[model samples]
Target chain A: MIPLLKRVAVILAAASFAGALVVAMLDLPAPTVHLPAAVEANMAASGVAHPVTAVLLNFRGYDTLLEVGVLLLALLGVLAVTGVRAAPRAVAPAEPAKRMLARLLAPLMMLVAVYLLWAGAIQPGGAFQAGAVLAAAAVLLHLTGILPGWGAPGPRLRVSLAAGFLIFLAVAGALLARGALLAYPPAQAGMLILLIEAGLMVSLGLILAGLFLLLSRDSGDEA
Target chain B: MSASLAFDLLLAAALLWSAWRALATPDIFRAVVLFIVFGLLLTLAWARLAAPDIALAEAAIGAGLTGALLLDAVGALGSRKDGAP
Candidate 1:
């Protein structure tokens, strides 16, 4: 059943590609520009002690803003595909052990999410990771039948989902009025970044959770 | 020759092998599981490269959240197939 010629062709192509990559790596040239040094030089003004955080939330806030928007759009796309009219259905109860474990772990995961959000200002954690952990908690709850798959998100839920992007946009608008986009005043940089991160953490959590929750309703209906 | 270098080489090999298996596996569930393993290995690689932020994100979002989503998709697909004629 095998196609020997095609397989041989594939092997040859792969070997050549690998050989090229190895040669390229071996003969790499030194960098012309040192971005890390530039980032380090400006770290004091970037508002966050953590260089990565500063780059993500301050130096390149526009990208993060767009990323948040993209995520929200993705959730909206999921909602559109799933159709907003599907009614929330009750899921059968999971095993008692799973239920209890979900109850125990959900709160702990929330605490970790918050800790990651807080630590992002000075360490290797941020809104994206924090929001992911929060979403995981919600997923765990749903899997255990503690939380039902979401139907059409209510007005309140919708607002929560958009809150992060809205907040980021508002900040950018205000900063633009003052001078430039997301250019936090040196004195207020820390507070502004924190505020943005807080908003993002909440909205990202909701949006990420919504992706799973919305699509999952179909399985519940089919079941 | 050093211990850390050896560990890094082993990790790299494991990453490549898992990635290959994830792609080549016939079983959808096994492939997804292998993909998750690949993600975790990638997180280790990120950590070894001194990027803990990336490692944490990879572990949580890449491995944890994506794995859950894929597993859910597989379950949904399997159930749909069973219900169909």
Candidate 2:
């Protein structure tokens, strides 16, 4: 009798969720919202043709900066909890096909990542997307034993991991000294955004790859 | 309904089905796999809503990275339970 009651409760919960979903689907307004003119004007001033990039890097720059810090914080939490060190080097998989795929795909992914970063100024790509792609490439390399395990990240890796957050903070600090916080000189806005984005892309890639490696069950044990 | 609407309906149904299975499955690994499928379906739904940027993020970070993390966690838990060397 209790089992039957439990099943009925589950069914009731599912039905409630389904009903809510239908209501939400029916109530959603048509996706024809207009972009505010002020946003367009600001986008022009921000110097990136891609509105999303401009907004993320300029209008809401602080949010993005804080987000990178949040990513770092997550890694720190994982480290404290797991206490698993990283291996100094990676072992290549025995399968020739896996190695071949890594060799062929790594360069291609790197190219695509860079392209995404560059195109973000004019298209749907941006620092976050480019960083994720770069991380994917790094994961591919690590998986196939092209790169060392993150268990023993060197000085270079440490610098790279902090590059994005540091660069962002520096920019914000410089702007604050000049006049307003995060307000770049109109003429140099484009260059500054690009510079920050480049640093962010590298750091984001490293941080993400580091997180994955750190969380893997045998990172330190394999070495 | 038009063909596109039919497609959208099918996609939404698929999303619900996969989500339900993921929640109800007895096997943890199967649930994770189904969750990944649900994330993929969400990516499609984002694209259908004309949010390509969000769709890209959902596909890469949401489905790809999260799925990888979850699978690793499952493996770790299984190993601990089995006392594998």
Candidate 3:
């Protein structure tokens, strides 16, 4: 038999939570300004027409820079906890259909990722979005056995993993000669933003893909 | 009053139900699958909220990557032969 008291408690808790959410949603006042005046005024100066990218990479560049550091730190932590080596697994034969799909879809996914990165200057796409797409493609490749190994990432992978952070720092440092940290010259802003994003996309993709690879390295070995 | 609103409400309900089931289900595999579905529902909710950027993020990072991770983790846990229904 169902526990009546427990059922009632769950119902009450759910109702209260839902009611509070609805009340909050209904009562929350809309912001008076859509985009802050500062953001609106200097949006064009940010190089990219997209406000979000501008804010992420320029207005609040320090935050993005630190966030990349945080991601790398997390990976470091994971590596520390997992140790230097993963137990080798028996190679499983790849299904032909999956192999064909991976070949067909990998290019398509890469193309989409490039498009997203390029579009970020004008549209909703940006470094994070493009990076995620590229990572997804990499994950697909790993899954379909196209990558050919479950071994620890090589030196090239390691360098590219840190590429985004390094490039961002270099850009910020270069701009110091002109003015404040990360402040690009007006004419060079667009080029700088694009350059930074391209590096960020590659690094973010590699980092995320490496994370998944680490997880799958010792598959079926633990509970 | 509009059909889209009705659809959104239905989607919200489904999201809530899926989330509850994902947490409460006894089967680990089923729970992981439900969690993935819940993530997709969240992607839809983000779209309905007029946040395409967030929707893309939810679809890619939240749903796709996290779901893949969870499923892989579950697979690594190994199956208990006697635990099967």
Candidate 4:
């Protein structure tokens, strides 16, 4: 009787909360400050044809920079908690069908990643999406035994992992020296954004993939 | 209502139902699968709102990566419980 009462109470609370949210949505007033028009007006000066890219990498660059830093920090936290040194374990070969799928898909995914990065300047894709696709490819390969679980990152691996954040920081610093943070010269903004995205794509891919690879190593140990 | 509005309403209902089931389900695997369904529904919602960028990100990172991670965790938990290789 008590359990049923408790469930009824919870459901009633949830229903009321959802109803309130719907009411709030229906009552929303028109915004006085229209951001899209403002963004459109400045698009030419923002150095990217895509409004979303312009805002993300140019106008609100600090947010993106900090986001990258946060991701790197999260990876560091995971490494510290797990202990950086991973014992190497032999992985039994995956079934032939799985192996073939991984082999065929990984390269194609890489191509898609590059395309997404390039398309960000004009379209809906960007470094985050591209990096995720790259990470997904690595995870698929690891699962299929084509790639091994990570141990302690080598010097080269460490550099690759930090390269994107460092490159982004360097650009921000250079722009800061000019006057303000991430204030790219209009003429050079396109090249600079592309360079940062390229670096970010590689680093973000490694860091995201590393999160899985590092954790999976412990599971592999027990198996 | 217009056909698009009707479709949007149906989508929203599915999203809410899936979210509720994902939380209330007894089986962990079924909950995770429902969560993935919720993510896909969210991706569709984003696309319907004409925010293709967010939709793409939701599909890849929110659904794909997160689903894989959750499934992996479930596998690890199951193995530990069974004490089987």
Candidate 5:
């Protein structure tokens, strides 16, 4: 009886959800924008505006910066933990089928990463998106032995690791000194986005690559 | 009701199902991988729900970094189990 009651309850819940979904689909509104007068005026004033990118690198710039910092610090921690002391794991060779696919996709992956970074300055894509793609590519390359680990991160790796943070902080500081913490260079908003976005792409990619180094290799296991 | 709202509901349901399965799975490793899948689904949900910034962070920190950490922890756990007499 208890089991039967539970089954009934589940059926009832599923039925109710389906009913609501049907109602929602029927009532779906067409796409429309009706901004208030003040916002409309503001948009007009900002003739050359990329609102999404602006929001990403200026309004919520701090959050974005910190997010990158988290990745950077994570890599640093991993490097310290496993750089020299920890014995490196020998990555298993990729299957022949996968190797061919990876090689075929490599150039395309590189192109997409570059495109995403370049587009971020003027359009929808940005550093984080591009960096993630680039990192995936790096992981693939590492896995295929196209770029083998040379034991311990060298001096170049150390400096490259912090490049994004150093660039972001210094530029933001200069901006703050002049006017606001990430304010455009007196309406050079596009350029500011470009600079930061470019720097972020490099930083994000390196940081992700560092995480790969930390974990050593892609091992199939659960936490 | 709107297109975005409909999309959100769909994504939410998917995310919930993944999370539920992740918790129920007997294999700890499978559970962790499911959790990462849950994160990915949630990131897509965020995008549909009009929070691309949140989605970006979710994919990077939540799915990417967190997944890597879980894999690392799994290795540590495996080694420890093996080390035990």
Candidate 6:
């Protein structure tokens, strides 16, 4: 009877907590935010394209570069902490039914990831979302034991991770030489944005996949 | 004030809650998993906030990379013992 009461109490508490979360998020009170109107107006007056991305990789390039460095340091730290161990093979026998399902669905997942990366130009989806999804595909391959060989800090992974920063810097240097740092051709805004975004997607995908496989070299765990 | 701001607030709340729960968990593996979920949640929020650059960084570097690192850390800390809880 006591155990039964405890179980009921626990369930009620969980339900109440979930209810609170829903209320907090779905029925948030109207917010009163005040900001100077001229801030955005001033941005439009200057006429620089993609002030956000500019800030991300150019004006704030130093910060982004530093952040990437930090990520590298963390990866290195993980490798150091966990002496490299080949990921263990799954102990369980694969059910033929599940294996067939996995085989059929895998290609579709990869296609969806590619489509997300390509369609990011004009939608809510973008390089980051696409890259994360792509990394998930790589993880599936790894889990299913169908992955081709992976080496630590492989050439492809190295190139993908470094390319984004290098390309951004190169573009910035060209603009600097032109006497306006990180400037884009006003007429070719769409083309330029598309280019940068594509590069970002590839770099992001590589960085994510590399981090996973590299760390897995020692830990070999994935979700 | 706007629909976007409201959305950002909700995202922020979710991130906070995930982080809190991850920290509160006693089991190490589950905590690590929840933390990874927190990272992914932040990526979605960043996108809605019109920070695609941040969203990219968060999903790839923050969520994916950081999650890998911490999971490896837990694995290094050693799995629970045969007799001990």
The local lDDT score (0 to 100) that residue B56 gets in candidate 2 is 78
What lDDT tens digits, residue by residue, belong to model 6 across residues B37-65? Answer: 99999889877767775776587667775
Candidate with the larger TM-score of 3 and 4:
4
User: For residues B1-85, could you state the per-residue lDDT of candidate 3 as single tens digits?
Assistant: 5999899989989998999999999888999999999999999999888777778878999999988889887887754453476
Residue pairs in collision within model 4: none
Q: Isolated chain A: TM-score per model? A: 0.92, 0.83, 0.84, 0.93, 0.69, 0.59
Question: What is the TM-score of candidate 2?
Answer: 0.85
Q: What share of the true interface contacts does each candidate keep?
A: 0.54, 0.31, 0.66, 0.43, 0.17, 0.29
Residue A72 shift from truth in candidate 6, angstroms: 5.1
Q: Deviation in angstroms for A138 in model 3?
A: 1.8
TM-score of each: 0.93, 0.85, 0.87, 0.93, 0.72, 0.59
Interface quality of candidate 2 as DockQ: 0.41
Off by over 4 Å in 4: A1-10, B82-85
lDDT of 4 by residue, A55-146 (tens): 99999999999999999999999889878764556356799999999999999999999999999999999899999999999999988888
User: Stretches of candidate 1 above 4 Å error?
Assistant: A1-4, A7-11, A221-223, B80-85
TM-score of the A chain in candidate 1: the value is 0.92
Task: Write down the TM-score for model 6.
Answer: 0.59
Of 2 and 4, the candidate ahead on DockQ is: 4
Q: Model 3, which residues run further than 4 Å from truth?
A: A1-18, A30-33, A36-38, A86-91, B79-85
User: Chain B alone: TM-score in each candidate?
Assistant: 0.89, 0.89, 0.86, 0.89, 0.82, 0.81
Lowest-scoring 10 consecutive residues by lDDT in candidate 2 chain A?
A: A214-223
Q: With candidate 3 superimposed using the best TM-score fit, by how many Å does residue B31's alpha carbon deviate from the native? A: 1.2
Per-prediction tally of clashes:
0, 1, 0, 0, 1, 0
Can you write out model 6's per-residue Cα lDDT over A24-101, one digit (the tens) per residue? 999987667633343344344222344554444434545654555565566567556644444334323346676666
Per-residue lDDT for A1-223 in model 1, tens only?
5699999999899999999999999999998999999999989898889999999999899999999999998998998888986568756779999899999999999999999999998999999999999999998898888898887788899899999999999999999999999999988999999999999999999998888888777775564
